[model samples]
Target: MDHLQCKVFFGLVICLWTAKISQAYQTVENDLTDENSLASSYFFYQRPEYPRDCQEVQDHCSYTNTSGLYLIKPDGYPEPFEVYCENRQDSAGWTVIQRREEGIVYFDRNWTEYKLGFGFLATEFWLGNDKISCLTNQKKYELRIDITNSYGMSFYAIYNMFRISDEVSKYNLASLGEYSGNADTHITWCKINTGYENCTCQKSCENPHECLDTCDDEDICICPEDYYLMERLCVPRKQCGCHMFEGILIPEGGVHADSDCSRLAICRNGQLRWDETYECGNNEVCEIRNNIRQCYCKPGSIGDGADCITATDCSDLYDAGFTESGVYNIKPTSWLEEAFEVYCNMSDGGGWTVFQRRIDGSVDFYQNWTTYEIGFGSADHEMWLGNKKLYHLTKQKRYTLRVDLVNREGSPYYAKFNHFRIGNKDSKYQLLQLGDYSGTADTQSTPNGYALTYHLNQAFSLWDEDNDAGSSNCAEGNHSAWWYKNCDNSDLNSDYHAAWGSDASIEWYYLPGSNYNILYTEMSLRPF
Candidate 1:
């Protein structure tokens, strides 16, 4: 051959070789059974052309026993359908096959390709039309054959070949009758027990309980050893406690404490029990320190290891001289300047004493505001002398309060010294100044007309004056005075007084270079 002819011939040979390899690779094995040699022969045979005389099967085509294959349902009931194939005489040996289910022929196909040899048969078919062609719609369709040793068995085993087109793979829809003589048995506890004579099945439980094998009856579920049942739940023996203490389970009447030995925790009736006896001494109080309970003295009291005493016990020091010399400074500039200093010479009775003397050129007031209640003096101490204490000021009690005033820098307006026993330590205290003494006064009488007692029994109610500026006296430059009978006494034997600085009066305001000072003050209680 010439060079051009050789090249053309070689090209043709390459094309044919590629086509054969492609066909072999495109062939899929019949995975439904291992007893068949049908897959190998199916791809080796040449496919036939479309049948010209092929006709579409009608919607209602009667089926006859042809291929004679049947399947058993999953429920062990025999399926009523059988496989059938009808030969089309005009279609040149082509045939149409279908399977009937429930008296209905649901699957039908016409084969244009086949391989019949090696005691097996494999056919490629389509569900579309009688004219056999390559699958164009990609719908699931299958047709294959298997020859097995069960040749002498039932008809289902003899010609166990079948196919389902339309997205159903043969392996997925194949029945047990096609592959085996006996039906498939589902393995369950009851079935296993029934199959074996000596098999004893125990009850199954979801909870953590022991399963009991009841040989004579249904199995029973019971708690394990040392476990108790509560509401059908098994609880361990160690958890049978009333409550937990510090994350350690504690039984009823159990006592536990931390390693530091501060508080003793007790559990009772599934709860932590609290006892006042576990607290501090009678005069002392309990307090939390570093998350542990400890005993400490209450406010205004000092405590030793055993007992508590009033902080103001001045029995050791001699009596300090009393002073009525007090000067009211123009409403104190700040809380720090709102106080006066007094000196008690150790001649008077001890008790609470006050002294303000110049030490190192600076005034030492002998008072510590931080030690009092809310930065105010308590009954047990000498600090916060100006703080209001209505609880200590009772009805029918005679009280003598000393006062002194000095205006270091003279003022254009007159200022007064206002004393009050207010309901609370709030803005109401400033608006409810009870007694006002101006000019150079050293002593002021208690139960004055401006005291709270004065308003208790008045014909007009004090609450009605809530909106009255002069009565409420809450606004600046609108201060006034009021009086009422003592509410504590039904006989109205005593009266109380209240007063505030009026317009243009600098009662509580203090200005620099203008010293409105309270030089001294002394308060004493006496029996009525």
Candidate 2:
């Protein structure tokens, strides 16, 4: 083939090879980019067509998923051009103006070449000074530069405000606002020369001056003065700390308390160690539980110890500001009384104090009278909210009790009573009143209707304390604690069972047919 023909053929081959490389690199980059870096670029290659501009591309990232090379037509541009939509940055909405990787394209060129731009779009290339000016002039723009050295150490510099001048003034870097990055303060200038001649080895945190007498003929690069060598890069001397938490560099030998002040952390010789010395704030106390020191709000107060406030019942909290369903410390009594946590169901209407909950059967509810009276298990998980607490809470206000249950088939049913009250422990915490039941759980045609009504006016019973008027120990037969007459129409406190018609299963009878398996059950009460 002739020389001219051979050149054209080789060019075609090179273009094909580069396209494959670009595709591979893009695939790998997408995998490595995390959800946090998604803000760096918005438009993906999957976008139906070219966007109007880079700003248009950024607006799409919220609902769109992918990020790669895309075509864009700026406001004043005559024709559309290809540009990279980058989403692998700290923030979003960026049009990559320039990129240099492995120096595949030589940068040294005449003024004409720089103005018009050159090099491959996917690999290493400049988007031309003319195009950059057009893009920046159309809208406000910021500049971010990512750099990686020979040792694979990476750093970034960001200028809050940046703009390029038109070609009239030779395309000068017109406006450059505040500069911010994790780099040394003295990085204002870059000196390019042979290693030893630049006093590279003499630079150190203690002595940052140019070497005058101890100059050696070895090629070595050392950190600048008032700077330390970290990860083979020169960093500010002030940054010589241990990065043990959330990528924050702690000062050398410095101690800091965690967010909750539960424990203290000390940085020593680039290492971090935690101490059990808790520094709790006011209205807080430090205690050792599960082999770790923790801070807890003091009696009659509610909080995670760092900021404690006076505690009140769930109703008062709902009226105040707390509107989320979770475990909250509440005091039903006066200021002098201690506060305890209760799972408050703050949804639906709000301020429903949960007395009992069974989710996954993780907590064993088969207990004696004292255990049932004082309560057991975590407030965050499955637990009985204690009969004593129930009596105190109910006595404070006229409450209506509501029982919410979910069966094995994921169907929900609720039982509500207009008037519900419990007697003190002296009466075995008897269900003194359960007036006018209304709910789907009692919609059966049986003569003994209203499932929960069977336990009304009956004293609470446990295997060890049989207050039930049944022929047998009802709590022992069902392996649960509940108010029982002869037995119960709804044994919600029974062991979790998957099979139907099992006597030991947590059941709500008659309404859903006899002895049906229930997956979840909760009993809560609130004042009208």
Candidate 3:
């Protein structure tokens, strides 16, 4: 090769080698914001097999091109595991640690139950002391999660229960108390649904070429996770019960009494008999309910009244501000009214105001007045409302509120009735809006910043909704977050919360922050 040619060839080779290595070593990580995005692997708890604690917990593991912190709940060891400092996605076998982001990625074992506190969704099926049981598609089964502390390790375990529309559908499910001895004795015991222990270390190989005669993984071949395997061969797993499983199988026809079949046994013609255990249908929690053994039931349908609703209901709850979309409305109660004696004073310069029972957050609008009264004063006598005292205005009531003033000479603020908190007593919160019969409420306007409308840039790319983007828009730093399309969903977690961008149509009014100790009557414009 010529000298010039040699140099070009060498450069090309180096570039190809670098690219190949990058491809082999990179992994993608993102914050787990959407509950739907979590994997089944995350919820699996084959106690007697895996401890059920978070594994990507050391730091946020990257998947689908985002980075986030993860944590387990319910006071197991490592109470608040500060998972990843910064989340990054680098290739597998690659050393890309320095790219970690500076935020938290969390694992929410508690999310399942957190959705239930409202008492509107499924009730009474949750395992452990907590109650937010998710019903899987299987016919006679229910699934719940329990987070427990074991020797300082956080164990997130799932409880599988049985259900029955017919008296026959119910089963008295039981599990072997996880074997407590060393791997040698192979001892075990029975208990209800709880506590997972590693069954034993299996040497089954992932690569067939590497198998030493066993040609399989040592895992107990649990359902769902093991659905890919049939007779130990990989296949698809979905929702339901089929072939058969061990237990006193429900007879082919309708009958109350148990036959000869035992859990781990099967049913052939019309009888409960023994056969190698097969995968139970979807939704089955692998328990011995009633006098039955190894039977299954759909999740959330313990009895006649407890059945889970269809997928339609699930979507409704998912949309019900659970994602923290806009400014959530706060309701008003009697204690709040008693706490603040709202007054509009033209003589003492009190102006118009809505007082909260506690430290006022901010305000949006005040009814029963002119539009002129809600903005900043254009003149000295602009008779506009003021947010002078957040904590203490020396009033008869403790007013936690949002005060609005028109055309404020200073920075403008925007907030909804949902933003204020009221009452040291009752918590019947309500947003003081036009109350369904919409009416005009004076609005406060402010100077604009590109803060909400940044163009395509690196910052935009950083907030990619899909991993498909290689070249993209995204700006750097904290300011870059709001510019994206879904910042509301992305930033609503309590750990790293950011108020979503606002739409001017909402007409926000809320009290600004209080430093009453410094200046009692404070006013500021907030639009978020």
Candidate 4:
């Protein structure tokens, strides 16, 4: 063959071979794409076994019905760890950060140990500082502490918002919102030793910024040279006693009366405890004000806490220096049965006895005649002092009635009467008398501003009682107990409505709008 023909023939053969190889490569790529799609589908259908928290597990894992020890993989955490899930308390889905039931685990640990965490989840455990920081930083968390004391009494403290800082900040508590609970006091327990055996630990109490040196190379905890070990806890010689009452550090052994002299607190063996030093009189109560437990005369009572005497009314209590607004026991007459509970509004001049009040929809005002005559609801919350109680209170002295109300928009208004009184059950507990009216609750129908006066001379009616002159039962129509003249010009004891313009809402008409709902209502009477 010629040289040119040979070169052309080899070129054609090489082109064909290249095309065949390209087609084979395309087929293999298509097979790999199909295999990849199948693998992706397989993973997509797989269950999410690793939950971020107990709440996620409760929501996603149907089999996880009961609360117990469970593994949770918190965000930013290295691996999953066991935590006690409390599904029974309050609602479900609570990750218990710390539990001290059997006291099998010693909480005394160094910084590194605390950061990494210790103890078994089944027994006592603190879910490590690092893990907690990671979990809390991921989202908002509420802390609920359930404590059962030595007396077998149970108490719970709930902090609405909680969070902590990262390791760089030593995992300090970054945020803690408002606290609410039944417990009277809040206490923070700081361990003296951060190791297995009780050992002295050097901590800079003077320099608050400096951290404590928990352990040494020999694995034994060491304290400052100046501090001595007391009851296996290290404390400075000057501050050997229990640290309490806003940094008031007592010596190793000390005894002092509490701020209010109500209790005697003793410091012994690096621990502080309290004993009741004084007991209140019959008409006195112990209350914690600004963390200081003190005894004071109750409502409608006077004298020192140890020797309180029953006062005639809220006015008497007001004169005796009982000024805080709250529920107080008032005795209208010398008779033992005449003493009853009433809310005393000690603000805005003081001594105003609240006979009827509705703040939240916690109490039901709709009732039978018997219920209205006696009373309903609690003295501290929403309550009606009762028609019988009201008659006795007003009969004791000439009272000025003040009706305070707040509309849905939170605008306050009031109606005041110079003279107010009610008749006994013989008159169906009628609102027998009302004097000159004045105030912002204007009827607009009348020349003067008093709107509730329309309800005067009318007998109080409940859902079961038909005393109104109107064709239909006013109390029944309004679904509340009230002094209804014809139907009602104003109804304070009506059903609490969230929105405005409801027929059954607690309302005062002709003030600004018709049938406007009142968010709060308080009918108080004060003796002039």
Q: Per-residue CA lDDT of candidate 1, range 59-81, in tens?
A: 11123122212111111122211
Positional deviation of residue 525's Cα in model 1 after best superposition, in angstroms: 7.4
List all candidate RMSDs to the true structure: 28.7, 19.3, 34.0, 27.3
- Model 2: runs farther than 4 Å from truth? 1-309, 334-337, 444-449, 498-500, 513-515
What would the per-residue lDDT of candidate 2 be over residues 1-528, giving only the tens digit for each residue?
111111111110000111111110111135545655433433234444444444465553333324356567665667667676554434434567676665568868888888878887667777777777776676555666665433334556666566778888888788767877753322223222111123344443233343422454443544444556554445555556665455445667666556666677777765778987567776676654443335666653666655777555677677766788888778776324567888888887888888898999899999999999888988878989899888888777778888988878887878888778899999999998877777777655753336788788899999999999978999999888899888887788888873435577798776563345688889988786
Candidate order, lDDT descending? 4, 2, 1, 3
Q: For each candidate, what is the lDDT?
A: 0.26, 0.65, 0.23, 0.67
Candidate 4 accuracy as lDDT: 0.67
**Model 4 spans > 4 angstroms off:** 1-300, 305-307, 443-445, 498-502, 513-515
Locate the minimum summed-lDDT window of 10 residues in model 1. 9-18
How many clashing pairs in candidate 4?
1
Residue 434 alpha-carbon offset, candidate 4, angstroms: 1.6
Instruction: Name the TM-score of candidate 2.
Output: 0.44
In model 1, what lDDT does residue 84 have?
17
TM of each candidate vs. truth = 0.21, 0.44, 0.16, 0.45
lDDT of 1 at 138: 21
